[model samples]
Target: MASSRGGGSQQVIRTGDMEKMSLDQLKAVKEQADIEVNLLQDSLNNIRAATGRLENASAALHDLSLRPQGKKMLVPLTASLYVPGTLDDADKVLVDVGTGYFVEKTMAEGKDYCERKINLLKSNFDQLIEVASKKKTLADEAGLILQAKLKQSSPSS
Candidate 1:
């Protein structure tokens, strides 16, 4: 009896009798499967490397979050003088310790640093995305090759 495969090809193998594939057909199938396996491995490796980079960036962010926000330093004023009128000498010696000002400056610097780091992380993420896209293309090509090989090897219908 004649049987038809899905791709408009006909084969004359009997319905009840199963025939073994030729050595070349078996080798072709094996090769197609190997290509699929290799493509999958490469995709996995790309994903792993991307994940590692993201993890490292996350760790750096965590470290930045844990950093001290700067402490104010106490400055003593020493002056031997007296204001005989209204304000006392101690009151007149109310000096700006400048700690608050310096803290604000330092915080600004830290913010700039964090921004730069975030930009770098974003760039790395973009690179990872590009890598993933390339891997996906490779995987798709491998899948198509396997499908075509399988279709070619199948009994025609």
Candidate 2:
């Protein structure tokens, strides 16, 4: 089968037509499928990284909830810098929602937000896995057909 994917639209030609396509057309199909597979893989990796970060944030929140107010701790300003500071409030925290926006939320609300986001990312990851699997299968089929065509055209010893 030949698949043309454009603007979220997929046009699949029947398998019978693929048998009639020239070598160049088969090669093109294989290449396009390969590109799509790579893109999906990158997306999967990014989702995994984001999920890990959320999990880490949840853990940090749990740890913070344990510390009493006025407890001395080193607050991180960057990867390599931290300043000594005393905890001012134990129940309230600033949550970075996104895009340079921070919102104030209680500890419980912050944890709930993290949980919701984690769940959403996991659901999207699963759906993307299904799509990536289908695209991979299509790429493999295109590759096999291309190889067969190549073998048929070459001289046999």
Candidate 3:
């Protein structure tokens, strides 16, 4: 069987084709399949990271919205340290608009923005998961085919 990946169409080795390929050809095909799996894994990792970030942002915004206005709280100066600060207005927040830009929005608007961004990130994450699963299935099939071919050629068998 064959699959059309982006850029061009490529042949996938089936049980029948695997029986005809030389040992070297089988190894080459296996290597290509491994590469595809690796690329898909990298993409999945990136999406996972983005999803985590969006979730964290959403949590922070929600927590901020619940805090009392004019209350002094510890603001995170670093991962391990927080400086004392006062919440002048729980009604507003600073939001990162990407490309090193930030925008001010009301707390309600900020929550809405977080919800929208989280939804977008989740959608991308789901797509990446689907692609990665397909690539992994392809890699596993290729590995099985290669193993069967190797076994057929073994003298002990």
Candidate 4:
């Protein structure tokens, strides 16, 4: 496999020749593999969090649709701050579509938006999981190779 390096240089390491590599080279490969694995895991975690938030929004939409119009409730203005208000139009709701943008949509449409976003995020999460699994396997193999090289270079007890 060819490992990409800075300055557009690539280091190619054949699987059959791992034992022939120097200790420093093996260590570098192991470190790079570990870093890639960590980054992939972080991406997977972010996708999971986004999916959870969308699911919660969908549930809140369902609950809101059940309430009658003109019902008095506490409307949140900021964290730990809410003002007493009455529901003016429950059927029409504002949806935050991200990047400081909000769009008005019917309650049913808002719920559908949330569901679609959840499905998209879930699909991305599944694809990322497969990539992460392969990276983890590569990292494990590099670690084992590095250990073997270290033992060969060290003095025996």
lDDT of each: 0.43, 0.83, 0.72, 0.78
The parts of candidate 4 lying over 4 Å away from their true place are: 1-14
The candidate 4 region of ten consecutive residues with least summed lDDT is: 1-10
Write model 3 residue lDDT over 1-157, tens digit each, in one string.
0122221455544656755777787677667767766775676676678668867887898898888888899998667999999999888788888998989999788878878887876776676567556666666766777788778778993
Question: What TM value does model 2 have?
Answer: 0.90
Of the pair 2 and 4, which is ahead by TM-score? Answer: 2
Model 3, residue 152: displacement in angstroms? 2.6
Residue 142 displacement in candidate 1 (angstroms): 0.4
TM-score of 4: 0.85
Say which candidate scores most in lDDT.
Answer: 2
> What is the C-alpha local distance difference test score of candidate 4?
0.78
Off by over 4 Å in 1: 1-105
Winner on lDDT between 1 and 3 is: 3
Candidate 3 lDDT for residue 150: 74
Worst 10 residues of 2 by lDDT: 1-10
Q: Return the candidate ranking by lDDT, descending.
A: 2, 4, 3, 1
Candidate 2 residue runs with Cα over 4 Å from true position? 1-8, 13-17
lDDT (10s digit) by residue, model 4, range 27-129: 7777877787777778888888888889988998898888899999887776599999999889998999999899999998999999999998888778777
